[model samples]
Target chain A: MRNIWTICRKELGGYFVSPIAYLLLTMFALIFGFFFWNILGYFVNEGMEMIMRGETVPMNLNEQIIRPLLSNVSVIGLFFIPMITMRLFAEEKRSGTIELLATSPIRDIEIILGKWLSAVILYSCLLLLTALNFGFLFLYGKPDWKPLLVGYLGLLLQGGLLLAVGTFISTLTKNQIIAGAATFGICLLLWVIEWVTGYESATWATVLAYFSVITHFDSFARGVIDSKDLVFYLTGIFLGLFATARSMESLRWRS
Target chain B: MRVLTCFLPPSAGTATVAGFDVLEQPREVKRRIGYLPETPPLYPEMATSEYLRFVGKLKGLSGGELEKRVDYVCERCFIADVKQKLLGKLSKGYRQRVGLAQAIIHNPEVLILDEPTAGLDPKQINETRDLIKSLAGDHTIVLSTHILPEVEQICEQVIIINKGKLVATDSVRNLQARTRGVESLQVEVAGRDGSLSYELVQRRLEQVPGVAHVLCRDPHEHRLIFEVQSQKGQLTRGDLARAVVESGWDLNELRAASMSLEEIFLELTGSDAPKETAELTKEMQA
Candidate 1:
């Protein structure tokens, strides 16, 4: 546990010291804010028209506006997680530092957990930037903060799962380009797997769709917090991290 | 799990270090062994001090212990001068030294260095050699290099592995002695008759007990060569010269052969088959 934390601290330091982390955060805010602004604008216009028509608006303001805003943020997250994770092991292998770490007193599992935790921390910081949207929503109207918090929770979970997958893919090759591309490919494929496969395969697709990261956003988009959705996200994160540990261990001894 | 077998397959054999089974106790093994690959592995953006502290922490050293070990390793490896420098900005020699420093940070019982002197200049090489020698009493170092003289300079017990198999493991002096007396004696005979001089000298030298083979010829003026072989702890060079004179052949010159480390290395690594004649011809020219 101590070794893992030490690795995490050093790895987190690497992210902040380099330009990559800052650039990723900037991109995260710009894209997520844009998505939030556009969605909020459309919903406000719809709500006003419903009021003018003398009709009760059916959708909850948080459900219609903030949830959709952060869900789109989760989609943007899929692209960025790989960017952050592509360097974890791929760069180490290319620079020949994998030998140093592998031969160290730390276990393979410790190294994987350390790097994964660093990405998690970076993603959390990036997610914090989207809090501006939630703050604005609170200022503009009498809106409940419950759904917004849950939506952010789902988004955080999704980011964790995606980062783990990205870090795992990074261990597949020494080339960063390949690591990045492979990570993006896996995330993109899993992201849209349900849409491409059609309804005939909806059972496995629905199960995979539940695991798609997009599906878990549903519970958070509303004011609901389901333990099943939480379990799904946790499982995804665990499997991805487990696979990463195995990948590193196998590569070291395969020589 | 502190030790694990590497390089060779686990099924073939196993080695334990500090009560760690190399296969099962790999973590414990890693904790007790400091390994430096051919290339130094380090984060470029990190300062030398920071990186060592990080590694020390990962090795489970406490705060005070980490700082102490980091400084100790840095000072021992002579890298304290560049402790504040980023690894990327440091020169190759400094980087290599930093790599060594990290390996020894945890003060493992055994240190494995693969080609530690590579890419170092003569001065740096000598400094590293001296450092490794100084570490002999405190640490068990297993360093691998193609440089034969280095083994003679530092190692008390040397093991040579070729193509993934252990070829020879013995003391430096013993290895030298095993090839001793197989060395030829070079004789430059001067002012002697050309005809009987060649034939008579060969016959007289062959009669000596330790003389396995002799080749006497007029290279410039006249030279006689003897490839001598004797049972260990047997005979002297004076006996051979006396025999030549007793045979009514003039003896003008006689000297025992000398072989450098390079020659011995080639002899040891070369084929064990009947290539002694070809190697002999090459050695004579050398």
Candidate 2:
């Protein structure tokens, strides 16, 4: 545990020391805030229209605004998660510090956990930035805080799963650009894997749709947390991290 | 060195350091070994002291123990002045020293250095050598370098591997002495008037007792030079000088030529097969 934390701290330091972390944070906030402002504007206008029509059913703020914002944060993460994990192992290999780590007394699992944990933490910080916008909704209106927390939890699980995949890809090469591009490609593919279910109803099609990251995330976005979706995100995270460990082990033997 | 350091696994067989099997117990092996790869493994974004502390933590040092060793190594490696400087901005010499410092920060039993002074200026190389020499009392140091003098200077027990095969393993003095079975003498002589040909001088030296071969070399100013090889355990310096003086030739220079480690390294790791190397090592041991 101590070893993992040390590596995680160093990795977090790596991110914060470079311009990449700040740039990613800023761009993500700018894009997420844009989406939030536009959605909130649309929600308020729709509520006024409902009032004007004498259909006085209270508009659901959670459904109309926060859910789409959380979903957009996941989309924004598709770009930023790749950036967060690109340098994790790639830069270490490029600069030859991987030798230092590889030859150290730490286990491969510890190193992997440390690095992946840091990526998850950085992603959390990005999610925390979106919380400021979420704060606005609470001050002006009453949305169930419980559902908002559940939505953020789902987002965290989904981001953790994808970041694990990115960590695995980062271990495959010494080039950060290749790692980043490959990670983005794989993340996008996983996001869109459910598209196959649209035209086919075969068993394999159902299986493919089941593997889509967005499919499992839909329930949580609806302000509901099912054990099935929780299991899916947890299993996805385990598999991604498992694959990363195997990649790291193979690299030791190959080199 | 990489194999011993647990960086690269061996294709076959295994190795043990400090009674720990590298393949079977890598973490245990790692705990007792300090390795410095050819390039100093450094994070450019980290300051020198911070990097040391980080490496120290990875090596399993905690709190006060880690900080004390960090300070000790920084002072020992002569990087104390640059402790706060970012590693990327530091000079190569300081970077190399920091690499060395990190390796020894944990104070492991075995210190494996791969060409530790490969790319340093003459002064820095000497300083680094002195630091390594000072470290010899506390740790069993394993240093590899293409600079023959470095091995002759710093190392005690030497292992030479050529193309991934063990060429020879012995002490520096033993390798030198083993190659001295057949001794060569550098003899420079000429007539009192500087008229004697090198060929004539070479023939005269060949006639000396115990001389196995004589080769004539170019004249050194007024003196003709001859390299005379004598059989094993022979001392023909006196005979060669007497023969030159008896022939009315002026003996300008006569000195025993010691085989340098560079020459012995080339001879051992050369095209010689493993069979010949094994035989040579066997003969040396005998």
Candidate 3:
């Protein structure tokens, strides 16, 4: 546990010292803020028109603005998670620092978890920064914070799952660009796999749709935390981390 | 080196470091060994002190001891001046020193340094060599280098590996002694009258017991230089001196030309080694 924490702290400290962390933080905040502004503007305009027509329809901020905003954050993550994760193993290998880590007394699992945890923390910090924008919504509007919390939870699980995948791909190569691109490709595929169900509702299509990240994320976006979706995200994250552990083990001999 | 350091598992064999199996008890082996790859593993963004602290922590040092060890290694490696500087901004020599400091931080039982002085200036090389020599008896240093002279000077035991196979492993003294048995003595002799006959001298020298071959070399000034090869386990110097004096020739110089580590390395590793030299290497391996 000490070894894992040592590695985690080192990796976390690494992110802050390099420009990569600030670059990622600013970019995520900017893009998410743009989506937040555009979505809220549209929601307000719709509410005003309903009021001018003197209709008694209630405004649902959670459904109208928050759901799409959370969904867009997941989409933005498809681009940024790879950038955050591509360097975990690839940079270590390229700079020959993997030798130090490999030869150290720490277990392979500890090293893997430490790096993945740091990546998660960095991504979470980005999520936390965007929470400031959510604070403004809370100050003026009465959108139930319950659904917003669930939406953020869904986004974290989905992002964590993709980060784990990116962590595995990062171990496959020493080139960070290749690792990032491969992670992006794999994440995008997971996002769009539900499209096949739209055309054909066959059994295989249903299975593919079940595998789609968006299919599970939709429930959380709508303020419902389905047990099956939670299980799916958790299991997917475990498998990704399991695959990363296997890759780390192979590195002992494959080199 | 990687296999021994617990970095990479061997394909078909098992190794132990400090009585710990690399495959079954890798953490134990790792705990006792400090490894420095050809390129030192460093993060560019880390300050030297921060990096050393991290390595010490990874090696199981904590609290005041870790802090003290970090300061000691910093002073020992001559990088105290750059302790606050980021590794990326330091020069190559300073970086190598920092790499070395990390390896010695926990003061493990074994230190594996590959090309420790590879990119350093001459002064730093000497300082690094002195530091390694200073740490010799207390720590088991497995220094891997391509510089033969460095091996000849710093190492007590030398293990020569050729094509991933053990070629020779012996004390530096013992390996250097390979220059002696069946050795060739360079003898420069001249006739007393400032003239000499190469044929006559060669004939007289070959008559000495245990002398294998006497090949005449070019005359230098007034002396005829002959490389008198001796048979295995024979020291023909006394008999040769007597024979040259009896033949009425002035013996100017007679000394064994010791073989260098480079020559021994080549003889053992070279594909085209002479028959006798190849046998010598095989004998050493045995």
Please report, in order, the local distance difference test score of every candidate based on alpha carbons: 0.76, 0.86, 0.85
lDDT of 3 by residue, A149-206 (tens): 9999998999889999999999999999999999989889998898998799899999
Candidate 1 DockQ score? 0.47
Most TM-score-accurate candidate: 2
Candidate 1 local lDDT, B1-286, one digit each (tens): 1123232236456788767777776777878877778788889999999999987876678878888898898889899899999899998888888988888888878787877888899988898888877776777777777676676677677665545455566667776776775656766543245555455556666778766667654444535544455444454778877787776666777776556555665676665533222211000000
> Using DockQ as the measure, which candidate wins?
2
DockQ category of candidate 2: high
For model 1 the local lDDT of residue B96 reads 83
Tell me how candidate 3 scores on lDDT. Answer: 0.85
TM-score winner between 1 and 2, please give it. 2
How far out, in Å, is residue A160 in model 3?
Answer: 0.8
Q: Of the candidates numbered 2 and 3, which has the greater DockQ value?
A: 2
Clashes of 3: 0
Instruction: Name model 3 segments beyond 4 Å from true.
Output: B119-121, B182-256, B271-286
Tens digits of per-residue lDDT, candidate 3, B115-137, equal: 78787888888888888887776
Cα misplacement distance, residue A83 of candidate 1 (Å): 0.8
Order the numbered candidates by TM-score, best leading: 2, 3, 1
